[model samples]
Target: MKKLFTIFVAAAAISAAAHATTAFTDAKDAVDYRQSAFTMIRHNTGDIGEMLQGKVPFDAKRVQQRTDALAALAPLPWPAFSTPGTESGGGDAKPEIWADFKDFTAKADKFQLDAKALQTAAQSGDQAKIKAAFAAFRGNCKACHDKYKAD
Candidate 1:
Protein backbone atom coordinates (compact mmCIF):
# COMPACT_ATOMS: atom_id res chain seq x y z
CA MET A 1 0.00 0.00 0.00
CA LYS A 2 2.89 2.37 0.78
CA LYS A 3 4.54 1.75 -2.60
CA LEU A 4 1.27 2.24 -4.40
CA PHE A 5 0.68 5.53 -2.62
CA THR A 6 4.16 6.75 -3.55
CA ILE A 7 3.58 5.98 -7.21
CA PHE A 8 0.26 7.72 -7.13
CA VAL A 9 1.79 10.82 -5.62
CA ALA A 10 4.59 10.82 -8.20
CA ALA A 11 2.13 10.52 -11.00
CA ALA A 12 0.05 13.36 -9.60
CA ALA A 13 3.13 15.60 -9.39
CA ILE A 14 4.10 14.80 -12.96
CA SER A 15 0.60 15.53 -14.18
CA ALA A 16 0.63 18.89 -12.44
CA ALA A 17 3.94 19.80 -14.03
CA ALA A 18 2.72 18.72 -17.44
CA HIS A 19 -0.41 20.77 -17.06
CA ALA A 20 1.62 23.86 -16.30
CA THR A 21 3.89 23.34 -19.32
CA THR A 22 0.92 22.71 -21.61
CA ALA A 23 -0.37 26.21 -20.91
CA PHE A 24 2.22 27.68 -23.32
CA THR A 25 2.58 24.92 -25.89
CA ASP A 26 3.55 27.23 -28.75
CA ALA A 27 4.59 30.81 -29.41
CA LYS A 28 1.11 31.93 -30.37
CA ASP A 29 -0.36 30.15 -27.40
CA ALA A 30 2.08 31.90 -25.12
CA VAL A 31 1.31 35.27 -26.66
CA ASP A 32 -2.40 34.73 -26.43
CA TYR A 33 -2.22 33.63 -22.82
CA ARG A 34 -0.16 36.64 -21.88
CA GLN A 35 -2.34 39.06 -23.82
CA SER A 36 -5.49 37.69 -22.27
CA ALA A 37 -4.07 38.05 -18.77
CA PHE A 38 -3.00 41.61 -19.44
CA THR A 39 -6.40 42.41 -20.90
CA MET A 40 -8.09 41.24 -17.73
CA ILE A 41 -5.61 43.16 -15.60
CA ARG A 42 -6.27 46.30 -17.62
CA HIS A 43 -10.03 46.00 -17.25
CA ASN A 44 -9.84 45.44 -13.54
CA THR A 45 -7.35 48.23 -13.00
CA GLY A 46 -9.37 50.57 -15.17
CA ASP A 47 -12.35 50.17 -12.90
CA ILE A 48 -10.17 50.90 -9.90
CA GLY A 49 -8.75 53.94 -11.64
CA GLU A 50 -12.22 55.21 -12.40
CA MET A 51 -13.10 55.02 -8.74
CA LEU A 52 -9.84 56.68 -7.77
CA GLN A 53 -10.38 59.55 -10.22
CA GLY A 54 -13.92 60.15 -8.97
CA LYS A 55 -15.38 59.03 -12.30
CA VAL A 56 -17.15 56.38 -10.27
CA PRO A 57 -18.30 56.16 -6.69
CA PHE A 58 -15.87 54.74 -4.17
CA ASP A 59 -17.38 51.54 -2.95
CA ALA A 60 -15.26 49.52 -0.58
CA LYS A 61 -16.56 46.19 -1.82
CA ARG A 62 -16.01 47.10 -5.48
CA VAL A 63 -12.53 48.46 -4.80
CA GLN A 64 -11.62 45.28 -2.99
CA GLN A 65 -13.05 43.21 -5.81
CA ARG A 66 -11.06 45.04 -8.51
CA THR A 67 -7.80 45.13 -6.60
CA ASP A 68 -8.12 41.49 -5.67
CA ALA A 69 -8.67 40.66 -9.32
CA LEU A 70 -5.58 42.63 -10.29
CA ALA A 71 -3.55 40.83 -7.65
CA ALA A 72 -4.66 37.49 -9.05
CA LEU A 73 -3.99 38.49 -12.66
CA ALA A 74 -0.60 40.12 -12.08
CA PRO A 75 1.54 36.99 -12.06
CA LEU A 76 -0.18 35.03 -14.83
CA PRO A 77 1.51 36.74 -17.78
CA TRP A 78 5.14 36.59 -16.72
CA PRO A 79 5.51 32.85 -17.19
CA ALA A 80 4.09 33.09 -20.69
CA PHE A 81 6.81 35.59 -21.54
CA SER A 82 9.40 32.86 -21.00
CA THR A 83 8.35 30.92 -24.09
CA PRO A 84 10.75 31.30 -26.99
CA GLY A 85 9.58 33.40 -29.96
CA THR A 86 7.27 35.31 -27.65
CA GLU A 87 9.64 38.26 -27.68
CA SER A 88 8.46 39.25 -31.15
CA GLY A 89 4.98 37.77 -31.20
CA GLY A 90 3.57 40.82 -33.03
CA GLY A 91 2.87 42.42 -29.68
CA ASP A 92 3.96 45.65 -28.07
CA ALA A 93 6.35 43.84 -25.76
CA LYS A 94 9.80 45.22 -26.41
CA PRO A 95 12.72 42.91 -27.21
CA GLU A 96 14.52 44.34 -24.24
CA ILE A 97 12.21 42.18 -22.19
CA TRP A 98 14.41 39.20 -22.97
CA ALA A 99 17.68 41.04 -23.43
CA ASP A 100 17.33 42.74 -20.06
CA PHE A 101 15.48 39.92 -18.40
CA LYS A 102 16.79 40.61 -14.91
CA ASP A 103 15.64 44.21 -14.96
CA PHE A 104 12.33 43.18 -16.41
CA THR A 105 11.88 40.61 -13.66
CA ALA A 106 12.75 43.17 -11.00
CA LYS A 107 10.17 45.54 -12.43
CA ALA A 108 7.60 42.78 -12.54
CA ASP A 109 8.35 41.94 -8.91
CA LYS A 110 7.82 45.55 -7.95
CA PHE A 111 4.53 45.60 -9.77
CA GLN A 112 3.36 42.44 -8.05
CA LEU A 113 4.36 43.80 -4.66
CA ASP A 114 2.51 47.04 -5.26
CA ALA A 115 -0.51 45.15 -6.49
CA LYS A 116 -0.59 43.11 -3.32
CA ALA A 117 -0.25 46.27 -1.27
CA LEU A 118 -3.21 47.76 -3.09
CA GLN A 119 -5.22 44.64 -2.46
CA THR A 120 -4.41 44.78 1.23
CA ALA A 121 -5.35 48.42 1.46
CA ALA A 122 -8.63 47.76 -0.28
CA GLN A 123 -9.33 44.96 2.16
CA SER A 124 -8.94 47.39 5.03
CA GLY A 125 -11.97 49.32 3.78
CA ASP A 126 -10.03 52.55 3.97
CA GLN A 127 -10.51 54.72 0.93
CA ALA A 128 -7.54 57.03 1.50
CA LYS A 129 -5.20 54.13 2.13
CA ILE A 130 -6.40 52.41 -1.02
CA LYS A 131 -5.82 55.58 -3.02
CA ALA A 132 -2.27 55.89 -1.75
CA ALA A 133 -1.57 52.26 -2.47
CA PHE A 134 -3.07 52.55 -5.91
CA ALA A 135 -0.88 55.52 -6.69
CA ALA A 136 2.21 53.53 -5.78
CA PHE A 137 0.94 50.59 -7.84
CA ARG A 138 0.26 52.81 -10.83
CA GLY A 139 3.79 54.16 -10.66
CA ASN A 140 5.13 50.64 -10.86
CA CYS A 141 2.93 49.88 -13.87
CA LYS A 142 3.93 53.06 -15.69
CA ALA A 143 7.62 52.49 -15.00
CA CYS A 144 7.51 48.98 -16.43
CA HIS A 145 5.41 49.94 -19.46
CA ASP A 146 7.65 52.89 -20.22
CA LYS A 147 10.68 50.62 -20.27
CA TYR A 148 9.30 47.46 -21.84
CA LYS A 149 6.07 48.04 -23.75
CA ALA A 150 6.04 49.70 -27.13
CA ASP A 151 3.62 52.43 -28.06
Candidate 2:
Protein backbone atom coordinates (compact mmCIF):
# COMPACT_ATOMS: atom_id res chain seq x y z
CA MET A 1 0.00 0.00 0.00
CA LYS A 2 2.73 2.44 0.86
CA LYS A 3 4.64 1.59 -2.28
CA LEU A 4 1.58 2.04 -4.40
CA PHE A 5 0.80 5.39 -2.81
CA THR A 6 4.34 6.58 -3.36
CA ILE A 7 4.31 5.53 -6.98
CA PHE A 8 0.99 7.26 -7.54
CA VAL A 9 2.19 10.49 -6.00
CA ALA A 10 5.44 10.42 -7.93
CA ALA A 11 3.74 9.70 -11.23
CA ALA A 12 1.25 12.49 -10.68
CA ALA A 13 4.00 14.98 -9.91
CA ILE A 14 6.00 13.97 -12.96
CA SER A 15 2.95 14.16 -15.19
CA ALA A 16 2.24 17.66 -13.91
CA ALA A 17 5.83 18.79 -14.16
CA ALA A 18 5.83 17.63 -17.75
CA HIS A 19 3.46 20.47 -18.51
CA ALA A 20 6.00 23.06 -17.52
CA THR A 21 7.86 22.40 -20.74
CA THR A 22 4.87 23.17 -22.88
CA ALA A 23 4.21 26.62 -24.34
CA PHE A 24 1.49 28.62 -22.66
CA THR A 25 -1.39 30.13 -24.66
CA ASP A 26 -1.09 33.34 -22.69
CA ALA A 27 0.07 34.80 -19.44
CA LYS A 28 -3.05 33.64 -17.68
CA ASP A 29 -2.38 30.07 -18.69
CA ALA A 30 1.12 30.34 -17.35
CA VAL A 31 -0.05 31.95 -14.14
CA ASP A 32 -2.65 29.26 -13.70
CA TYR A 33 -0.11 26.49 -14.18
CA ARG A 34 2.36 28.13 -11.83
CA GLN A 35 -0.23 28.59 -9.12
CA SER A 36 -1.47 25.03 -9.42
CA ALA A 37 2.04 23.62 -9.22
CA PHE A 38 2.87 25.75 -6.18
CA THR A 39 -0.31 24.67 -4.47
CA MET A 40 0.55 21.00 -4.89
CA ILE A 41 4.07 21.61 -3.62
CA ARG A 42 2.66 23.40 -0.58
CA HIS A 43 0.27 20.58 0.20
CA ASN A 44 3.00 17.94 0.24
CA THR A 45 5.43 20.09 2.20
CA GLY A 46 2.68 21.06 4.64
CA ASP A 47 2.11 17.39 5.39
CA ILE A 48 5.75 16.91 6.27
CA GLY A 49 5.61 20.04 8.44
CA GLU A 50 2.58 18.67 10.24
CA MET A 51 4.40 15.43 10.99
CA LEU A 52 7.40 17.29 12.34
CA GLN A 53 5.27 19.56 14.50
CA GLY A 54 3.27 16.72 16.03
CA LYS A 55 0.14 17.98 14.37
CA VAL A 56 0.23 14.58 12.76
CA PRO A 57 2.02 11.41 13.70
CA PHE A 58 5.45 10.99 12.22
CA ASP A 59 5.35 8.44 9.47
CA ALA A 60 8.74 7.90 7.89
CA LYS A 61 7.22 6.34 4.83
CA ARG A 62 4.91 9.31 4.33
CA VAL A 63 7.83 11.70 4.74
CA GLN A 64 9.74 9.86 2.05
CA GLN A 65 6.73 9.89 -0.22
CA ARG A 66 6.22 13.61 0.22
CA THR A 67 9.88 14.33 -0.41
CA ASP A 68 9.84 12.23 -3.54
CA ALA A 69 6.79 14.11 -4.72
CA LEU A 70 8.60 17.34 -4.00
CA ALA A 71 11.57 16.30 -6.11
CA ALA A 72 9.30 15.97 -9.10
CA LEU A 73 7.32 19.13 -8.33
CA ALA A 74 10.26 21.42 -7.68
CA PRO A 75 10.97 22.10 -11.34
CA LEU A 76 7.42 22.72 -12.41
CA PRO A 77 6.64 26.30 -11.48
CA TRP A 78 9.80 28.23 -12.25
CA PRO A 79 9.53 28.00 -15.99
CA ALA A 80 6.11 29.57 -15.95
CA PHE A 81 7.57 32.85 -14.82
CA SER A 82 9.61 32.92 -18.00
CA THR A 83 6.59 32.50 -20.15
CA PRO A 84 6.51 35.69 -22.24
CA GLY A 85 3.48 37.50 -20.96
CA THR A 86 3.66 36.33 -17.35
CA GLU A 87 5.37 39.58 -16.43
CA SER A 88 1.95 41.16 -16.72
CA GLY A 89 -0.07 38.10 -15.84
CA GLY A 90 -1.76 38.88 -12.59
CA GLY A 91 -1.21 36.77 -9.53
CA ASP A 92 0.64 37.08 -6.28
CA ALA A 93 3.81 37.56 -8.30
CA LYS A 94 5.16 41.10 -8.39
CA PRO A 95 7.01 42.84 -11.21
CA GLU A 96 10.32 42.36 -9.43
CA ILE A 97 10.67 38.80 -10.68
CA TRP A 98 11.28 39.99 -14.21
CA ALA A 99 13.06 43.11 -13.05
CA ASP A 100 15.54 40.97 -11.18
CA PHE A 101 15.33 37.97 -13.45
CA LYS A 102 18.81 36.75 -12.69
CA ASP A 103 18.30 36.79 -8.96
CA PHE A 104 14.88 35.27 -9.30
CA THR A 105 16.28 32.47 -11.39
CA ALA A 106 19.05 31.91 -8.92
CA LYS A 107 16.59 31.69 -6.06
CA ALA A 108 14.48 29.25 -8.07
CA ASP A 109 17.59 27.15 -8.60
CA LYS A 110 18.27 27.21 -4.85
CA PHE A 111 14.73 26.05 -4.21
CA GLN A 112 15.29 22.96 -6.33
CA LEU A 113 18.52 22.28 -4.50
CA ASP A 114 16.76 22.66 -1.18
CA ALA A 115 14.09 20.21 -2.27
CA LYS A 116 16.75 17.66 -3.16
CA ALA A 117 18.51 18.23 0.14
CA LEU A 118 15.26 17.65 1.99
CA GLN A 119 14.82 14.34 0.20
CA THR A 120 18.32 13.30 1.14
CA ALA A 121 17.77 14.31 4.76
CA ALA A 122 14.51 12.38 4.97
CA GLN A 123 16.15 9.27 3.54
CA SER A 124 19.04 9.49 6.02
CA GLY A 125 16.64 8.78 8.90
CA ASP A 126 18.39 11.40 11.02
CA GLN A 127 15.87 13.46 12.94
CA ALA A 128 18.07 16.48 13.46
CA LYS A 129 19.22 16.53 9.87
CA ILE A 130 15.71 16.15 8.58
CA LYS A 131 14.39 18.96 10.77
CA ALA A 132 17.17 21.29 9.77
CA ALA A 133 16.71 20.42 6.10
CA PHE A 134 12.98 20.97 6.33
CA ALA A 135 13.50 24.40 7.80
CA ALA A 136 16.00 25.28 5.09
CA PHE A 137 13.69 24.03 2.36
CA ARG A 138 10.89 26.24 3.65
CA GLY A 139 13.15 29.27 3.70
CA ASN A 140 13.05 29.44 -0.10
CA CYS A 141 9.38 30.33 -0.05
CA LYS A 142 9.83 33.33 2.14
CA ALA A 143 12.97 34.40 0.39
CA CYS A 144 11.25 34.63 -2.95
CA HIS A 145 7.90 35.84 -1.64
CA ASP A 146 9.39 38.75 0.22
CA LYS A 147 11.00 40.15 -2.89
CA TYR A 148 8.95 38.82 -5.80
CA LYS A 149 5.46 38.02 -4.64
CA ALA A 150 2.97 40.80 -4.10
CA ASP A 151 1.70 41.92 -0.70
Candidate 3:
Protein backbone atom coordinates (compact mmCIF):
# COMPACT_ATOMS: atom_id res chain seq x y z
CA MET A 1 0.00 0.00 0.00
CA LYS A 2 2.74 2.44 0.90
CA LYS A 3 4.70 1.69 -2.20
CA LEU A 4 1.63 2.08 -4.33
CA PHE A 5 0.81 5.39 -2.70
CA THR A 6 4.35 6.60 -3.26
CA ILE A 7 4.27 5.60 -6.89
CA PHE A 8 0.91 7.24 -7.35
CA VAL A 9 2.14 10.45 -5.77
CA ALA A 10 5.24 10.55 -7.92
CA ALA A 11 3.27 9.74 -11.04
CA ALA A 12 0.68 12.38 -10.28
CA ALA A 13 3.33 15.03 -9.68
CA ILE A 14 5.16 14.15 -12.87
CA SER A 15 1.95 14.22 -14.85
CA ALA A 16 1.03 17.63 -13.54
CA ALA A 17 4.46 19.04 -14.21
CA ALA A 18 4.55 17.53 -17.65
CA HIS A 19 1.21 19.02 -18.60
CA ALA A 20 2.07 22.45 -17.24
CA THR A 21 3.16 24.46 -20.24
CA THR A 22 4.19 28.07 -19.92
CA ALA A 23 2.26 29.15 -22.98
CA PHE A 24 1.01 32.28 -21.34
CA THR A 25 -0.31 34.01 -24.41
CA ASP A 26 -2.49 36.26 -22.28
CA ALA A 27 -3.18 37.48 -18.78
CA LYS A 28 -5.90 34.94 -18.20
CA ASP A 29 -3.60 32.13 -19.24
CA ALA A 30 -0.96 33.36 -16.88
CA VAL A 31 -3.43 33.64 -14.06
CA ASP A 32 -4.69 30.15 -14.70
CA TYR A 33 -1.19 28.79 -14.82
CA ARG A 34 -0.20 30.31 -11.49
CA GLN A 35 -3.48 29.26 -9.93
CA SER A 36 -3.04 25.66 -11.03
CA ALA A 37 0.54 25.59 -9.86
CA PHE A 38 -0.28 26.99 -6.47
CA THR A 39 -3.19 24.60 -6.10
CA MET A 40 -0.87 21.69 -6.77
CA ILE A 41 1.69 23.05 -4.34
CA ARG A 42 -0.91 23.43 -1.62
CA HIS A 43 -2.29 19.95 -2.19
CA ASN A 44 1.13 18.34 -2.09
CA THR A 45 2.15 20.19 1.05
CA GLY A 46 -1.13 19.41 2.70
CA ASP A 47 -0.53 15.75 2.02
CA ILE A 48 2.75 15.95 3.87
CA GLY A 49 1.14 17.93 6.67
CA GLU A 50 -1.46 15.23 7.06
CA MET A 51 1.22 12.66 7.58
CA LEU A 52 3.09 14.88 10.00
CA GLN A 53 -0.02 15.51 12.04
CA GLY A 54 -0.90 11.85 12.04
CA LYS A 55 -4.07 12.42 10.11
CA VAL A 56 -2.39 9.91 7.85
CA PRO A 57 0.21 7.32 8.61
CA PHE A 58 3.85 8.28 8.43
CA ASP A 59 4.99 6.82 5.17
CA ALA A 60 8.48 7.95 4.24
CA LYS A 61 7.92 7.15 0.62
CA ARG A 62 4.75 9.20 0.61
CA VAL A 63 6.57 12.09 2.21
CA GLN A 64 9.27 11.90 -0.43
CA GLN A 65 6.67 11.87 -3.14
CA ARG A 66 4.80 14.92 -1.88
CA THR A 67 7.92 16.90 -1.09
CA ASP A 68 9.39 16.07 -4.46
CA ALA A 69 6.24 17.41 -6.05
CA LEU A 70 6.43 20.56 -3.96
CA ALA A 71 10.07 21.18 -4.80
CA ALA A 72 9.25 20.99 -8.50
CA LEU A 73 6.08 23.07 -8.24
CA ALA A 74 7.54 25.86 -6.08
CA PRO A 75 9.13 27.81 -8.90
CA LEU A 76 6.27 27.61 -11.38
CA PRO A 77 4.20 30.52 -10.08
CA TRP A 78 6.77 33.32 -10.19
CA PRO A 79 6.71 33.88 -13.94
CA ALA A 80 3.00 34.38 -13.78
CA PHE A 81 3.56 37.25 -11.40
CA SER A 82 5.34 39.05 -14.21
CA THR A 83 2.25 38.84 -16.40
CA PRO A 84 -0.13 41.73 -16.89
CA GLY A 85 -3.02 42.41 -14.53
CA THR A 86 -1.64 39.94 -12.03
CA GLU A 87 -2.42 42.32 -9.23
CA SER A 88 -5.93 43.31 -10.26
CA GLY A 89 -6.99 40.31 -12.29
CA GLY A 90 -9.62 39.18 -9.80
CA GLY A 91 -6.98 37.09 -8.11
CA ASP A 92 -5.85 37.42 -4.52
CA ALA A 93 -2.49 38.77 -5.53
CA LYS A 94 -1.76 42.25 -4.31
CA PRO A 95 -0.24 45.09 -6.29
CA GLU A 96 2.73 45.07 -3.98
CA ILE A 97 3.98 42.08 -5.87
CA TRP A 98 4.81 44.29 -8.85
CA ALA A 99 5.54 47.41 -6.87
CA ASP A 100 8.11 45.54 -4.83
CA PHE A 101 9.32 43.15 -7.44
CA LYS A 102 12.75 42.66 -5.91
CA ASP A 103 11.35 41.72 -2.53
CA PHE A 104 8.81 39.44 -4.12
CA THR A 105 11.40 37.55 -6.09
CA ALA A 106 13.57 37.22 -3.03
CA LYS A 107 10.70 35.75 -1.11
CA ALA A 108 9.89 33.40 -3.94
CA ASP A 109 13.50 32.29 -4.07
CA LYS A 110 13.51 31.70 -0.35
CA PHE A 111 10.43 29.57 -0.71
CA GLN A 112 12.05 27.50 -3.43
CA LEU A 113 15.09 26.93 -1.23
CA ASP A 114 12.99 25.99 1.76
CA ALA A 115 10.97 23.62 -0.39
CA LYS A 116 14.18 21.95 -1.49
CA ALA A 117 15.16 21.52 2.14
CA LEU A 118 11.80 19.94 2.88
CA GLN A 119 12.29 17.59 -0.04
CA THR A 120 15.66 16.60 1.30
CA ALA A 121 14.23 15.98 4.74
CA ALA A 122 11.45 13.91 3.27
CA GLN A 123 13.97 11.81 1.46
CA SER A 124 15.90 11.40 4.69
CA GLY A 125 12.85 9.66 6.17
CA ASP A 126 13.28 11.32 9.51
CA GLN A 127 9.98 12.46 10.93
CA ALA A 128 11.50 15.13 13.13
CA LYS A 129 13.54 16.52 10.29
CA ILE A 130 10.59 16.50 7.96
CA LYS A 131 8.45 18.32 10.50
CA ALA A 132 11.05 21.01 10.99
CA ALA A 133 11.60 21.43 7.28
CA PHE A 134 7.88 21.53 6.62
CA ALA A 135 7.45 24.24 9.21
CA ALA A 136 10.22 26.28 7.65
CA PHE A 137 8.74 25.86 4.20
CA ARG A 138 5.30 26.85 5.43
CA GLY A 139 6.79 29.89 7.09
CA ASN A 140 8.38 30.94 3.83
CA CYS A 141 5.10 30.54 2.01
CA LYS A 142 3.24 32.52 4.64
CA ALA A 143 5.72 35.37 4.53
CA CYS A 144 5.26 35.79 0.77
CA HIS A 145 1.53 35.37 0.89
CA ASP A 146 1.19 37.90 3.67
CA LYS A 147 3.02 40.48 1.67
CA TYR A 148 1.74 39.69 -1.84
CA LYS A 149 -1.55 37.84 -1.64
CA ALA A 150 -4.75 39.60 -0.74
CA ASP A 151 -7.32 38.13 1.55
Candidate 4:
Protein backbone atom coordinates (compact mmCIF):
# COMPACT_ATOMS: atom_id res chain seq x y z
CA MET A 1 0.00 0.00 0.00
CA LYS A 2 2.83 2.44 0.83
CA LYS A 3 4.51 1.60 -2.46
CA LEU A 4 1.26 2.24 -4.32
CA PHE A 5 0.85 5.54 -2.53
CA THR A 6 4.38 6.59 -3.41
CA ILE A 7 3.78 5.74 -7.05
CA PHE A 8 0.58 7.72 -7.05
CA VAL A 9 2.37 10.76 -5.64
CA ALA A 10 5.08 10.48 -8.23
CA ALA A 11 2.48 10.29 -10.98
CA ALA A 12 0.75 13.37 -9.65
CA ALA A 13 4.01 15.29 -9.53
CA ILE A 14 4.81 14.34 -13.11
CA SER A 15 1.38 15.47 -14.20
CA ALA A 16 1.92 18.82 -12.54
CA ALA A 17 5.30 19.32 -14.16
CA ALA A 18 3.82 18.50 -17.56
CA HIS A 19 1.10 21.00 -16.99
CA ALA A 20 3.65 23.67 -16.07
CA THR A 21 5.83 23.03 -19.10
CA THR A 22 2.83 23.57 -21.34
CA ALA A 23 1.41 26.51 -19.45
CA PHE A 24 3.10 29.13 -21.56
CA THR A 25 0.99 30.14 -24.54
CA ASP A 26 3.29 32.81 -25.96
CA ALA A 27 6.84 34.05 -26.06
CA LYS A 28 6.16 36.56 -23.33
CA ASP A 29 4.82 33.90 -21.04
CA ALA A 30 7.80 31.71 -21.63
CA VAL A 31 10.17 34.60 -21.08
CA ASP A 32 8.42 35.49 -17.86
CA TYR A 33 8.69 31.97 -16.54
CA ARG A 34 12.33 31.68 -17.44
CA GLN A 35 13.19 35.05 -15.92
CA SER A 36 11.43 34.07 -12.73
CA ALA A 37 13.49 30.94 -12.53
CA PHE A 38 16.70 32.88 -13.09
CA THR A 39 15.81 35.36 -10.39
CA MET A 40 15.48 32.57 -7.87
CA ILE A 41 18.73 31.08 -9.08
CA ARG A 42 20.53 34.37 -8.62
CA HIS A 43 19.20 34.82 -5.10
CA ASN A 44 20.29 31.38 -4.03
CA THR A 45 23.61 31.74 -5.78
CA GLY A 46 24.22 35.07 -4.10
CA ASP A 47 23.65 33.61 -0.67
CA ILE A 48 25.99 30.75 -1.31
CA GLY A 49 28.62 33.06 -2.73
CA GLU A 50 28.42 35.34 0.25
CA MET A 51 28.85 32.49 2.66
CA LEU A 52 31.78 31.09 0.77
CA GLN A 53 33.52 34.44 0.51
CA GLY A 54 33.27 35.03 4.27
CA LYS A 55 30.86 37.92 3.85
CA VAL A 56 28.50 35.70 5.76
CA PRO A 57 29.53 33.03 8.19
CA PHE A 58 29.16 29.55 6.86
CA ASP A 59 25.94 27.90 7.86
CA ALA A 60 25.91 24.31 6.80
CA LYS A 61 22.15 24.03 6.60
CA ARG A 62 21.83 27.26 4.63
CA VAL A 63 24.55 26.22 2.23
CA GLN A 64 22.80 22.94 1.63
CA GLN A 65 19.50 24.71 1.10
CA ARG A 66 21.02 27.07 -1.46
CA THR A 67 22.86 24.28 -3.27
CA ASP A 68 19.72 22.23 -3.42
CA ALA A 69 17.86 25.20 -4.84
CA LEU A 70 20.57 25.74 -7.42
CA ALA A 71 20.44 22.12 -8.54
CA ALA A 72 16.67 22.22 -8.92
CA LEU A 73 16.56 25.62 -10.61
CA ALA A 74 19.46 25.12 -13.00
CA PRO A 75 17.41 22.97 -15.41
CA LEU A 76 14.30 25.11 -15.41
CA PRO A 77 15.35 27.91 -17.77
CA TRP A 78 16.76 25.94 -20.71
CA PRO A 79 13.48 24.61 -22.03
CA ALA A 80 11.95 28.06 -21.94
CA PHE A 81 14.77 29.35 -24.12
CA SER A 82 13.80 26.72 -26.68
CA THR A 83 10.21 27.79 -26.62
CA PRO A 84 9.02 29.21 -29.94
CA GLY A 85 9.37 32.98 -30.31
CA THR A 86 11.23 33.42 -27.04
CA GLU A 87 13.90 35.10 -29.07
CA SER A 88 11.57 38.03 -29.65
CA GLY A 89 10.52 38.34 -26.02
CA GLY A 90 13.18 41.00 -25.41
CA GLY A 91 15.26 39.54 -22.60
CA ASP A 92 19.02 39.80 -22.08
CA ALA A 93 19.57 36.81 -24.31
CA LYS A 94 21.54 37.60 -27.44
CA PRO A 95 20.84 36.31 -30.95
CA GLU A 96 24.08 34.35 -30.83
CA ILE A 97 22.32 31.87 -28.58
CA TRP A 98 19.81 30.94 -31.27
CA ALA A 99 22.43 31.09 -33.98
CA ASP A 100 24.50 28.51 -32.17
CA PHE A 101 21.98 26.65 -30.09
CA LYS A 102 24.08 23.52 -29.92
CA ASP A 103 26.85 25.37 -28.17
CA PHE A 104 24.43 27.10 -25.86
CA THR A 105 22.88 23.81 -24.82
CA ALA A 106 26.26 22.30 -24.18
CA LYS A 107 27.10 25.15 -21.84
CA ALA A 108 23.74 24.79 -20.15
CA ASP A 109 24.34 21.10 -19.65
CA LYS A 110 27.62 21.95 -17.99
CA PHE A 111 25.88 24.45 -15.77
CA GLN A 112 23.43 21.84 -14.59
CA LEU A 113 26.20 19.35 -13.95
CA ASP A 114 28.12 21.85 -11.87
CA ALA A 115 25.02 22.70 -9.90
CA LYS A 116 24.51 19.03 -9.09
CA ALA A 117 28.15 18.67 -8.11
CA LEU A 118 27.86 21.59 -5.74
CA GLN A 119 24.72 20.08 -4.30
CA THR A 120 26.51 16.82 -3.68
CA ALA A 121 29.41 18.59 -2.07
CA ALA A 122 27.07 20.52 0.16
CA GLN A 123 25.30 17.31 1.09
CA SER A 124 28.59 15.79 2.22
CA GLY A 125 29.09 18.72 4.64
CA ASP A 126 32.67 19.20 3.62
CA GLN A 127 33.64 22.86 3.41
CA ALA A 128 36.62 22.15 1.22
CA LYS A 129 34.61 20.19 -1.30
CA ILE A 130 31.91 22.83 -1.38
CA LYS A 131 34.42 25.58 -2.09
CA ALA A 132 35.98 23.77 -5.02
CA ALA A 133 32.63 22.69 -6.45
CA PHE A 134 31.22 26.18 -6.03
CA ALA A 135 34.07 27.69 -8.02
CA ALA A 136 33.37 25.42 -10.98
CA PHE A 137 29.64 26.00 -10.74
CA ARG A 138 30.03 29.76 -10.60
CA GLY A 139 32.43 29.84 -13.53
CA ASN A 140 29.78 28.34 -15.79
CA CYS A 141 27.78 31.57 -15.51
CA LYS A 142 30.47 33.94 -16.76
CA ALA A 143 31.44 31.69 -19.65
CA CYS A 144 27.88 31.50 -20.93
CA HIS A 145 27.09 35.15 -20.28
CA ASP A 146 30.13 36.42 -22.11
CA LYS A 147 28.81 34.89 -25.32
CA TYR A 148 25.04 34.59 -24.95
CA LYS A 149 23.83 37.35 -22.66
CA ALA A 150 23.40 41.02 -23.47
CA ASP A 151 24.77 43.77 -21.28
Tell me, by lDDT, which candidate is best: 4
The digit string of per-residue lDDT tens for model 2 on 104-143 reads 9999999999999999999998878989999999999999
lDDT of 4 at 79: 86
Q: Rate the local accuracy (lDDT) of all candidates.
A: 0.87, 0.91, 0.85, 0.92
Cα shift from native, residue 15, model 1 (Å): 14
Candidate 2 vs 4: which has more lDDT? 4
Candidate 4, residue 36: lDDT: 93
TM-score of each: 0.83, 0.83, 0.82, 0.84
For model 4, where is the 10-residue window of minimal lDDT? 17-26
Off by over 4 Å in 3: 1-23
Residue 121 of model 1, lDDT score: 96
RMSD of each predicted structure = 4.7, 8.6, 9.6, 5.9
Clashing pairs in 1: none
Scored against the true structure, residue 11 in model 3 reaches a CA lDDT of 100
TM-score of predicted model 4?
Answer: 0.84
Instruction: Estimate candidate 3's alpha-carbon lDDT, on a 0 to 1 scale.
Output: 0.85
Question: For model 2, which pairs clash?
Answer: none
**Once all C-alphas are superposed, what RMSD does model 1 give against the true structure?**
4.7
Ranking the candidates on lDDT from highest down gives: 4, 2, 1, 3
Task: Tell me which residue pairs clash in candidate 3.
Answer: none
lDDT comparing candidate 4 with the true structure:
0.92
* Top model number, TM-score: 4
lDDT of 3 by residue, 1-151 (tens): 9999999999999988755744244666678789999999989988888888999888898889898899899999988878766565567888887888999999999999999999998888888998999999999867888888877
